[model samples]
Target chain A: MIQFHNVTYTYNFNTDTCKDAIKNINLKILPGEFLAIIGQTGSGKSTLVEHMNGLKKPTVGEVFVSGQDIWQKKFDITKVRFKVGLVFQYPEHQMFEQDVFSEIAFGLRNNGIAETKIESLIFEALDFVGLPHDILNSSPFDFSGGQKRKIAIASTIAMQPDVIILDEPTAGLDPYSSELLLKKFKDYNKNKGKTVILVSHSMEEVVRFADRVIVMHNGEIKMEGEPRKIFTKVEELNEMGLDVPQILKVFLELRKLGFPARADIYTVEEAKQEFFRLKNLTKGGKSFVK
Target chain B: MLNNMMVGQFFAADSIIHKLDPRIKLLLTFVYTLLMFFIESMFIFTFNILAIIMVYKLARVPLKILIKSIKRMLPILLISAGINIFLIQGETVFKFLGINITKQGLCMVSTMIVRIICLISGMLLLLYTTSPAELVAAIEKILKPLKIFKVSPEEIAIMFSIALHFVPVLLLEAERIMNAQRARGAKFDSKHLKEKLKAYITIVIPLLISTSNRANDLAIAMESRCYHGGENRTRFKILHYSAYDLYALLISLLYVLLLLIFNKLDFFKIVM
Candidate 1:
């Protein structure tokens, strides 16, 4: 598990325009868990995640990643980075190689891996992202937006990091492509038992895919629990300027109309199941009441 | 990472200096730089220094900022001062370690140092009070009359405007590229020089490519948006000189007159 101890980060410290980005945040992230971090813009979600792999260090406290202090004097931070892969927003901008083959090979080459294994790793990553082999020798900049994003992710995956952090991976992507990417993430977590932390604004994606959810407000953790437990508190989430999934909102609205319904239904499948149960109850002249 | 650059950095305020017209500020800076050579006596330069101090106070620029500017230029100041101290022989005033300190050299050096300081302060008054946009506008206005000589002052003004606007954007872009490379384990902060150099090569290659791409994109964007050359283009902001500029002009004229009067005086010369 990765742990945080009284972490606080302030920008422009000791200046007139000093601001507290994150304050006294302490939490533990278990391995192999699909964790979703939801927060408003400027709520310190990015700052907190940047500290996971030593991209940033807390001004007042410490972060221990997998039982080791990330800021140890002798620690090779590059090794930590290899273990915790971070894909920033607009990952396509990270693509700088002349061709897709070199792009995916970039990470492995930097880590001192053998040249013989790089070809196989590149092919495996390409397969994982579902890109055709013909595109390997082509310029990454020539592809469509969704294709470029996949190539960027493939480069990150070639390193085989135990933990992968994706920040707003579905941003600017269509729903179909977004679902495919989410399914890949789910498979990675299930098949490899590796940690997957997703930072996104989509409540639907967070609820549909995340095993656990953490709600943040003004740089502090307002709530954290299993997605089912977290989805039950619709009122509190609304107060934080956040939303539950549309299915959950529909279920809540049905209850408000005087029909008994579950507030924790977060997916379309769950909504369909609830509707089927309601139909069976009404067919026998049974009354629906909260 | 490069965001703290201070070239032409303006201090935002509502003081009289800040309120003066950019053209008037530019004109006054030129006058003060030339006036530095007119004073013939140490006492007059001392009086002039006091006047500058009063003007600086009127501008309300923090002394801390002024100190930082001087500190940034300290090496230039010290080297010039040192060169004068060792060379230029005259009647010796003091002997230290069998080396002579000349009277004329000391007088000339102090005068040089004061003049340099005054010139820099006068230049900084404009930069500290006037924003970069205003400075470029002032330049355009001053050069407008040169159009009779077949000059295109507006084009130069546009160039300067574009340059100033992109400096911050380019710095941020470079930082972003560096961060992207860092995440890929490029090791920019490695202790080994060769490794660090190799890491920088990775960043620089991408930076160059991105810069060219941005340039092409900007050109296309401008063209597609119907950006014509600076011919018959009406300005959005028309600079107007108000009573504040009139008062600044009068004060600058009075200072120039004082320097002209000091040109003939040799009392309190203090050659040493």
Candidate 2:
């Protein structure tokens, strides 16, 4: 588990006008959990998670990852970074290689992995992201936006990090690209049992992929619970300048309109099943199968 | 990061000074700077100060901003003043322990200090009022004749604009890299100059690499956007001169005349 105990961080502390980015707080994230952190910009969500990878340290408190003090003097941060791979927003911007193959291999090479095994690992990472070998030799700059995002994620995955943290991975992507990315993330979580921490503001995306939801506002955790539980309170989330998944909003509307529908439905499929069951009951045993 | 800092140096304003034709302003700045060197009298200094006040007023620039400009020059100003007070040979003021302060030396020192202040103030006024992009365009226009020598004005313009734009970006990046290094146990102030230099080198290497990448990315992005050169390019905001500009030129000329009168009045002696 990754834990934050009474952590507080103020950026630009040496200057007179330092800003408190994260307040004192305590939280624990269990292993293998697909956790989604939702917040507006400068809400301390990014600051809190950076501590997990030793990218940032708390000004007052301590951060422990996998029961080890990350801020310890002898702790090899490169190793810590390997354990928790962070893919920042617009990950494609970080790509500097001439081709996709070399781009993915860059991280593994940095980690002192064997040269012979690098090709196999690169291919595996590419396959995991569903990119073909033909494109591997091509310039990353020549690829489409969605393809670039895939290649970026593939590069991070090649390092075989135990925990993958992505910040707005699907931002600016088209509907199809977003769906593809979400599916890949879900696949990685299910098949590899990797701990996934996704930082996003997309309610639909979070509700679809996250098992646990973390809500942040003004440098503090506003709420934290299961997706169903957190998303059910449409009013509270709305008041906090956040929105719920469209399906959840629809369910809430249905409930308001006197329909006996569940308010916690996050996906379209779940809402569809509830609607179908309700229709059948109202039809008095008449099966209206479409 | 240094580039980013320079970018922020070109403050933006929408006053009369900002609205002046950049080409005219550039030429006027040079003329004004040259005239300051010619003026070796207290009356000329008074005239210069009046001109500064008038420009500041017309620009609607705050006194606080003017004070800020002065504050930035304080260290150099004080240094020059100190050197004149102690190091230079002059008529003795008090004969402090075999030291002499000559009357001629004191006069020379004060005039030099005034000239420096005037030069600094003039440059600050120019930069404070003009946007960096407009200054780039102005410089490009002035250097347009150099195109006959196979010099690409467009390329130079792009370089100027890019440099201006990236100053803040680089400064922010430096701060980020420095913070990252600090978090990794890199001490910038460990009472050892070599260790401090090493810390700075670590910061500089990454900064240089990232800047290179940014430059490459910017080139690609610009190319993709069909930025061939300034040859066929038309400005989105074309500058024009108004009555205010004519009046400003007239005032500047009058100020120079007053400076000449001051030299004749013997308020201060001409150095050359």
Candidate 3:
């Protein structure tokens, strides 16, 4: 679990160019939950998540991980990083080892895991990311973009951290690959009961998978609730330069046209079910379909 | 740690120096360096320092920022001055722990320090006043005559601009890679040299790959846009010499004339 108390981060602090990246942020992430943070670019989303793992020190307040203030004088930040893993955006760019196996083992080796145990963890992570065993000896650069991304994720997961924070892992990936990657994280959250925090711009992805959503704008948390509750405020989201899921937008439009369609439907399956129920009602005689 | 570098960073200000043509500024900087080397008397050095201070004030650059920029060069200044203080052979004025401190050495050290400071400040003044884009355009215009030897000025200018543009960006990428490695428990603050070097390898290899990958992508994007080696190309903003540039050139000439005159009048020389 992580908690932020009155945290504020200012970039270029003590300089003329200093500007607040995040201001007075108070947040708590419970154990074993999938939380998504959605925001427009430069909305302090990245700055907020960087503090969770002690990668960035807050300018004003404290970040407590598991009831320990991370910035305490005696506390070791490296140990905190091992407990809270952060997979940055385009993590594949961080790959450096000669081969996939060593690349995946990089974090484990850094954590001082025994040589005998690193192999098993590497293979387990590769299996979780759906990478083939034969490619272990191949160089990571020899793989395609999607496979490289998988290798990067496998590298992070091999460390077996308690909390996993991903900053826009799905960016620049094909839709199918994006969905597959998110599904893996979902399984990691559900089966392993690990805390998963995803920073993303995709509303559909967030609505489909996240249990709770936090919307950020102008360095402040503007809204926080379940995806269904958050997506209902379409106008406010638009004003913040964000969008709701496409299916929810369609349903909202349908409701605006005097149909009985629910404006809260987000996923395609829910939208389809709502349309079918409306069609049945229309077939009965009291219909607003026209 | 890497953010302290002031290389190639432009400070924006609304002043005559900022508005002067980049070509003129570049030429004036060259002339200033040449004139600095020609000084052999303390009077000329003092006059040069005063001129730099006056120009710095006219440019409206913050005093603190200028001092901060100079602070980075302090170690080099100290090392060179220390070497000159004891090494120069001249009249011995004193002795410290078996080392002879010479009067001539002290004079040489002060003169060298002033010259170096004046040179650095003059170059920084040029960078602080001109934007990178304007500098590139000015270079292209100045190098236009090199086309006769099968050289392409536009290509050279584009390369210079791209290199300048990516310095800060690549620095940011390097920082990002460093943070990612740190998240994996790589300890960069380790005191052992070998461990520190190993930690840096994680950052270096990834940064190199990403740099090449970015270069490849940029090349493809440029090619797709039908870039054909800058042949028959037109510029969006053409470089032009204005009255400000002329005035700047005149002032620099005047400074050089004063320096030449001071070189002959050694009446206020420091006795060596």
Estimate, for each residue in B49-168, the C-alpha lDDT of model 1 and write its tens digit. 788778778888876777678677778988998889768798899876777888888888888887787778778878999988999999999999988998889878877888788778
Off by over 4 Å in 2: A8-19, A41-44, A54-62, A67-76, A172-177, A285-290, B1-4, B7-28, B32-125, B129-272
Models sorted by DockQ, best on top: 3, 1, 2
Residue-by-residue lDDT tens digits, candidate 2, B1-272: 23212411655667878788877788788998998888777656866787788877877766566666677678888888767767777556666556776666677778888888788778777777888888988888888899899998888988888887877788877776564443333456557898788668757865776798789999899889988776578887777778877987897788667677776677665542
Name the regions of candidate 3 deviating beyond 4 angstroms.
Answer: B84-86, B93-99, B228-231
Candidate 1 colliding pairs: none
What TM-score is obtained by chain A of candidate 1? 0.96
Worst 10 residues of 1 chain B by lDDT: B1-10
* Model 2 Cα lDDT, one tens digit per residue, A1-290: 78888999888675555898999878898888899999878888878777778877788898888998888897866677777888777666555567788778766765778999999898888887788888878888788878888898888888888888888988988888788878887888889898999999899888889999999988999999988789877778888888989878887777777777777787888988998978877787654342
DockQ of 2: 0.10
lDDT of 1 by residue, A1-290 (tens): 67899999888777777888888899999999999999889988988888887888788888898899888888888888888888888888767778999888888989999999999999988888889888988999899989999999999888989899998998999899899998999999999998999999998899878999888899898899987888788789889888888788888888887777877788888889999987887898877664
* Docking quality band of candidate 3, CAPRI definitions: high
Please give the distance, in angstroms, between residue A143's alpha carbon in candidate 1 and its true position after superposition: 2.5
Which structure among the candidates has the greatest lDDT?
3
Which residue runs of candidate 1 sit more than 4 Å off their true CA positions?
A: A284-290, B32-54, B69-121, B146-159, B191-194, B204-237, B256-272
lDDT of each: 0.84, 0.78, 0.89
When only the first chain is scored, the TM-scores of the models are 0.96, 0.93, 0.97
- Residue B81, candidate 3: Cα error in Å is 3.2
Clashes of 3: 0
